[model samples]
Target: MSDLPLRSQLAVALGRTAAKMSRLAGKGDGSVIGGRIGLRLDPELLTRLAKDRKLVLVSATNGKTTTTRLITSAMTPLGEVATNAFGANMPTGHVSALASAPSAQYGVLECDEKYVPQVLRETGASLVALMNLSRDQMDRAAEIWQLAGKWRRALAESPGTHVIANCDDPLVTWGASTASGVIWVAAGQHWREDSWCCPECGGPLDRQEGEENSDWACRQCHFRRPTPQWALHGDHVVDPHGRQIPLGGIQLPGRANRSNAAIALAVVAQFGVPPEQALPLLAQVKSVAGRYTTVEHQGRTLRLLLSKNPAGWLEAFDVLQPAPGPVALAVNAQGPDGRDTSWLWDVDYRILRGRPVFVSGERRIDLAARLEAADVQFTVVDDFEQAVMSVPPGHLDVIANYTAFQDIRTRYGRVV
Candidate 1:
């Protein structure tokens, strides 16, 4: 940072100062505001700070934060990794991350779906991982296919950047199909309503029914799920050598996390790190941004999980404990949460029919209506703590949307 151009050095220094002030003021961790000030001072700060760093960008609707954290952990053994570990996925956050660790040789950034192209252009990332695309924040963001088209154009222009893409998702497959170099991964997509049609052709996609690595092809075009170099089988990720790397001991729960681990391992392998070498590091990650964090509060074990959209909620359901264990859900229609609760209907709440369910939040009424329609019985409480107290003393799982999740985290002393 000292050797940077005078303007860049000033920008970094001011950014750090502003971030410190932000932390002092209890505004935030200073990631966003600090970077915003730096970029205001030097428009090229992100590009300048990103120079000489080996960067990888991870973007997706459901698992961006988790996957980014996983990749960061897997790469830590190689060198110091500068990353946006707090779920800040914008350009400003990118600047803050790069500026904070000027000496770090590696970076793993979690990018928002819409900002992937811009971040890729600015950072010139060596590897950009494309995971599944789905409907999220629909009121504020572009359609899934439109976002994919932007990614396709961006990847096409950057022929030198290698792409690690999920082939099971038609939108993600179409996005990376135009890239010069692509490493396809057979990461399972549990939600299919968003990609019922072929991204390349305006026709229905023919999806083959199978247990793992199911095939999907367009009826109107030749575009289809590419033969993946790495595939996620049950409890393992199949490497290029047909070796089954067991995803055991990963503290994060569910097959979605296993898929995240597969992608992270595939990413580290590009830097010559073997899966065996990275697996232990990946297993060390217990949670990302408090998504799967388990905390003991009020004599009850509460596992916190975040589910901002239908795809996220489906994955959250997959990680819940066995039936009859009390589960609490909360939702809020805030600016960050897109201010639209209609997407609640897309979630299948019938899966909670047998579980003891509790609903609470600013939008708990909306969630309750959906639960009522699903024929699931749930009790509405004032907030997360009240819901937790209503359940038994042993264990309870909590799933909440953006603002609601943060509220609970705040009550627990902010577990980030």
Candidate 2:
């Protein structure tokens, strides 16, 4: 901060002060507000703070927060890491995070899919990690292909920054393929609905059957999944050296987290940290922004999981407790959560057919109607806490969309 120009230094100071006040007032994490204030004072605050620091920008439709948390943890042993611990992904959050830890040696920033290009250009990040891309917050964000195009153009312009990208998602591959240096990771992609057509030629994408992690190719064009230098092979991550490193006992659940861990390890390896050393650090991250937090409320154990879109819900279902365990599904069409509930139809509610289910949120009726069509039995309890209480007094899994999940976090006194 001292090295920054007078205006940027003042902006940093004011931003930190505002963030402190926000925390004291119990308003919010202070990242967003502080960032807004800082940017208003100094438009170039992010670039000024990013000077001389090795930074990594992570962007994806799903797993951005978790992957950023994992990367921060893996990089912590090297030095103090400046990161937005909360799910603040825009430029404002980036400013707040860098301002809060001005002297940190490194930064790991989680960027929203739409803001990736802008943040990438602003921060001049040395490494950009691209995970899977899917349709999310359709009413608010750009189409997946448009975002991929932006990323491709951004990387083309910034030739010095290396890219770590998921090869499974064709859109991500197409975006990162233009980078001068790219470490492609065969991070698994569960959501294929959004990437059925090749972004390169608008051709039908063909998936090779029986192949390990089925390879995708364009039926009408030359675009195809690049052979990954780092690939997630079953329970282990195959590094660039072809050495299989086990993803040992990572506290975060599901294959999605395993993919995140693999991506994190790949990112840390760029800094010369061995996968053997980083995997243990990645395992230390139990919860990311309260995504996998479990708490006891009113004699009932509630395991909270956040599923914003169909892809996220698909992964959440994999980590859910065995069938017959009461499950609560909450959703909201709030501003933060794209005001369209049509994405609910993209999820397969039939999987919850045999299980006891409860729906709650501003859009509980929409969710209930979807469940009805899927043959899932559910009770609509408008109150989130009451919905939890209505379930049997035992262990229950609660899956919610963005705002609904935040509401649960607020009710439970902010699970971190």
Candidate 3:
């Protein structure tokens, strides 16, 4: 803390005041803007806050926020964990989270995919969790392979960091493959469009018929899925010998979260928390930010799920279609959400064909067009709050991209 600049100290003070004012004005979470102003004032703020903490950095394309929450939940048995809640993966938000919990020893951070390497370089985090990689925000993100390449190089450079990586994803496997101390976890990856080939040799990965360890070996290069210390074998996350680790209170729905729990459980165990101890803590997390939170907006209640890309959309598809009521699929091409809505074209919206679909948001037209092409019937609800209410009553399912997700959540809490 002594190494911090005078300007940096003043910046954090001002940023906290602004955050309090933002909450008073009821602007929003105030995390993003407050951190933004603080970082603008003190560019080195994240480094300072990250110092002297046993940091666990979680980065992934799909499950960063929820997984970070899961990690935080599990690690509570260990001690105080400082994590950036809401959608605060950016540098500024990282700074703000640390500022809020100034004395917390365990910092569990959800680093944005693009910002992971920078955080690793600056923060000196001891444990780095690299989850699956997939296409997202094409306008802003590097090609998934490029991002994996960056991780590979970063891990190679930082040999002391213990890496927790998903072996199910070829990209993630390739990225942390060379890390000195890697605990591979079989976190499932359904989205494989971008991970079809070997990241090392660029050769087609061998998925031969009835082949053992095709999941284990790349026929072309040295790169292969390392033998995982932990894995999800069907329902239960198994042990080193393939024995089941009883997952009793996993509250988050679907296999995606189970996979997340498997990874999170493995991660905290490294931090000295046992898997059995981890589950009960992780299970208490019913919703993350607003991923699975039911928000009552304008007298209409909906369980909001954030779906940004095809992979994310796939995860929410199971949740949305199985619900008792109509499903609303909202989309937008805002800057926070990439302006390119072409990614929507790649999503399998055809699964919603039999269900009533309520499409809304800035680029609802683009989504509506995609749904139309998929033969899915949808009504374009221009007024978002009405769209939120328009869905059939009782246990409603509403899945939205980034901006639209935040819109309903903020409105539900009186923020407009």
Candidate 4:
């Protein structure tokens, strides 16, 4: 920060002042607006603050926030590290995190898929973790292939960055393949719709589906999944040539998180944090921006979870299966959650089969219709609070998308 021009320092001070006022006013976390104001004044504030810091950038269509949080924790033993706390993945969030903690020696951040290459370049990040790529925010975001192309070009330019990528997802594999040095992790990917065609050639690719050891190949263009040095086996990630390493301390359920843990461990291992040391850091993470956390609200305690797209929903549904009904699925179509709710049709609602589900949110009717088509029994309690209270209770899994999830956290989880 001492290297930054005086005007840049003033801009950051103004932004920090705005952030403090925002918190005082109970508006929300000041990361977004504060960073926006700062960037408007000093366009290069993001890159300026990133200089000389040990940086790690995490990006994915899903699981990025959780994976980034896990990676940040694994890097903690290294000392003071700045991280994005609100799951803000865009440039603004990165600016806020770096500017707010100018003295920090390291920064770990989750970057939006399309913005990953730019963030990597601006931060001159030493390590990048690429998880899986799938359809998300379909109304506004570029196609998955286009994002992959951007990553490929960006990595080609940033020859100094080492990549930690998922080997199971073809798009991620292709994107990370050209990095200077890459550590492959066989982190599992469940959604396959976007990756059926070869990224190299527009022909169909071959896929062998499995929980942890899935394989994919593109015979037309000779593109294939890299053999991973770290692979997921059942509940834990293992090195086939080495000993079994348990995916411990991670409180989040679902194999998806286990896969996330495997990728995080791989990234930190390059920094000299072995599985024994790194795994525990990740295990302490119970939630990423309230994905799997319980909070007392109204008369009952509501266990909260959030999923944005079909791929995310599938994993959240699988994790909450043992939870007692009636399940509260609050969904909305505000800008942050994507305006189009058509993706609701893509989610496997059949998993909610026998359980009683209560739909709430601005787009509750849209979700109800999708559930009806699948013959999943559900009741709509128009009031989100009433819906959560209506759950039959041994425990309840209350899942929401972006905006609605934040609303729940603000109204119910915190200040209730």
Candidate 5:
């Protein structure tokens, strides 16, 4: 077991070396070594996690990385926290991250939906935060219900663990029913449009109907949205004890982010950090790269929105108010991000609203076809540079899928 750590260290070093070689060889996918290392070291890494270590696992289709980052960042003021920041949410990624920090006081890690069961079982985390379950990477993740089932079983076994859940998502609410203690955080009515229907009943879900804000409930059945044990009212997130954490000028936008911000506050609150101390640090935290990140090209500003799935694309569209200039969107058929381009249909393309959109990527044609079918106007470009060049100067909106996001970031020299 001692040698296992050394072997894992050697493997991680070799993986880094291989990644460098791949980049030098001009065959950089940026995921080659991480992928290989994840597949190989996962089993050995899981076996090595000591039961004494206190683990905090965060999972969801969207916002896992961002929420994990926020929670980890907020927790740092309290004590040592080990985390996987690079979207490595699977078993191997958890192992690699854990292996990297052998003696962390707390393991604050993000976990992928499909890998949550394995991570929970092996890592033995004291706290598990499930942000929300949405349709993402459908080809790999299957239905939302299937993922929920796995989580349900996993949570049943770990009855002692604390669970942080988004009450708006039915899948997460159902999955977290068995949790020992759940800290719920919900977005107000402004962002609740997409969640009106129950995923379970195909019937209208009852929402707290006051205004057009994001408040939620089940209409047809009695499965109503739970009033958050911890709730966010604009910039203030209130815990169950009525303690208020004033979040001023968060780095991310929209009500979706409010939900994430609330969860982050709740997670940090669980670690006993006073709301006053942690609330001040949130304004300093920045959005994860490619997720609403803005870049300057020549004299114009291009905002990058990483839309990896239908729910993500819809939410991105929801958050965006109509911009004055033309919008640029990119979609790709790459692995990990999925080669199947059909998931775009699930997005509310009608929201485009006759905006002049420039589409490009490996699946540019597919995007164009979908736009055409929806009667939305768009011009297609195969070259990303040409596509960016096509956008007129001054405040451009750009939305791109996974590979395209990396491509644009690389082109702009923003990749880490």
Candidate 6:
């Protein structure tokens, strides 16, 4: 705890020791040492030192990592931006990011939804980006209403802060309604339209009729999904700068990425970067470590999609190509990735469309049972290597949960 300035050096030493111990004991997940070090450190010291630095905090049910990375890429041309790009979006992770960064002018962090309020209070972020909220980690995250209550209080306390919000989500729209100022980002019909029911009234949300792009309105009351101050229409971004940046050639797939790109553009737009300048920077960005990242293994290409909840899983399934070959799913019931495996039932597994799936992980049997109940045919393999090897030497798509994502990437000997 006393070793504040030497934290990075100590982390490196402890990481090496943990790696050696794991190798000796033939164990994985070298988290024991990291956990011990994390418990011993003082978060106050990290926060006090970071007060002079500019901070950008991004929080949501999904798209945090991808959006954080994209914002960081755009902000890099302006100044140094520190971030936790490895999915460690916790309090301790923020401390580690501060310890590891090289005197940055700005800090960009992807915060967990549950921890965002605490993080915002501790870090005093100048700019905060709140993406859509949805049902995620229900067993651990309590109810969606409870989470929304926390966010509402958090935003209310954070006055005069530049807020970037997604107006498409009902809960987020309500939370940001009282914000001092908000830059709203909306998507076309490509955005997930599954959870559009009004959070307050339980009435059906209305969408624009006959329009290719959809906008939401409450059928029962005046609570409506506010028109985005900045919108992404197809590849063009109508920016606050009055510049329409053409951003058609994004490498990442799905409509969700467009929403993420819009949020990233909004964040950078606050820093006085023109949309035209930032869109080109965002266009050249690649996927983050685990979210839809592709890697090569043994002469075959494997695309890895990290799906932690039903909404994220559904979005990934939307972008998945239904090929005649094989598709693999890795499920886990480990800590930090939720212990209850019932969320598998909530996922629209019917999207598999009779295609064969190879399932593996700690919760492999549970996932297999869910698939069977859904009348989906799947081959269950407890061994990770067996599952990967079972894929017929072609383009393989791997959809995995938080814990299983590390296993699949490690097995393929690829950095995600």
Best by lDDT: 1
- Of candidate 2, the 10-residue stretch with the lowest lDDT total is 207-216
lDDT values, one for every candidate: 0.90, 0.90, 0.82, 0.85, 0.72, 0.74
Q: Model 3 off-target regions past 4 Å?
A: 1-7, 208-217, 297-300, 321-324, 385-392, 414-416
Instruction: Report the lDDT tens digits of candidate 6 across residue range 1-416.
Output: 23345764565446446545865786643334443464365335446546777888898888898999889888877877888776668776676566556477789988888887888788778888988777677767757666776877887888856688877666777766666778877643333443567767778887776542457788998888777777777766677655676668677787778878888888987887767677778877767885677777665678898888887887788678665556789888888788988878877687675676898888999998888888888898878667667766668888999879887777675454
* lDDT, candidate 2, 84-132, per-residue tens: 8788999999998888898998999999888878887888899999999
Span of ten consecutive residues with least summed lDDT in model 4: 317-326
Please give the distance, in angstroms, between residue 397's alpha carbon in candidate 2 and its true position after superposition. 0.3
Candidate 3 lDDT score at position 123: 90
Off by over 4 Å in 2: 209-212
Of 3 and 5, the candidate ahead on TM-score is 3
What TM-scores do the predictions have?
Answer: 0.98, 0.98, 0.93, 0.96, 0.87, 0.86
Worst 10 contiguous positions by lDDT, candidate 5: 187-196
Question: For model 2, what is the C-alpha lDDT against the true structure?
Answer: 0.90
Per-residue CA lDDT of model 5 for 287-380, tens digit only, reads: 6755777888887788887778776786688666475457788998888778778888766687785777888888888899889889888888
RMSD of 1: 1.0
Better of 2 and 6 by lDDT: 2
lDDT of 1 at 256: 89
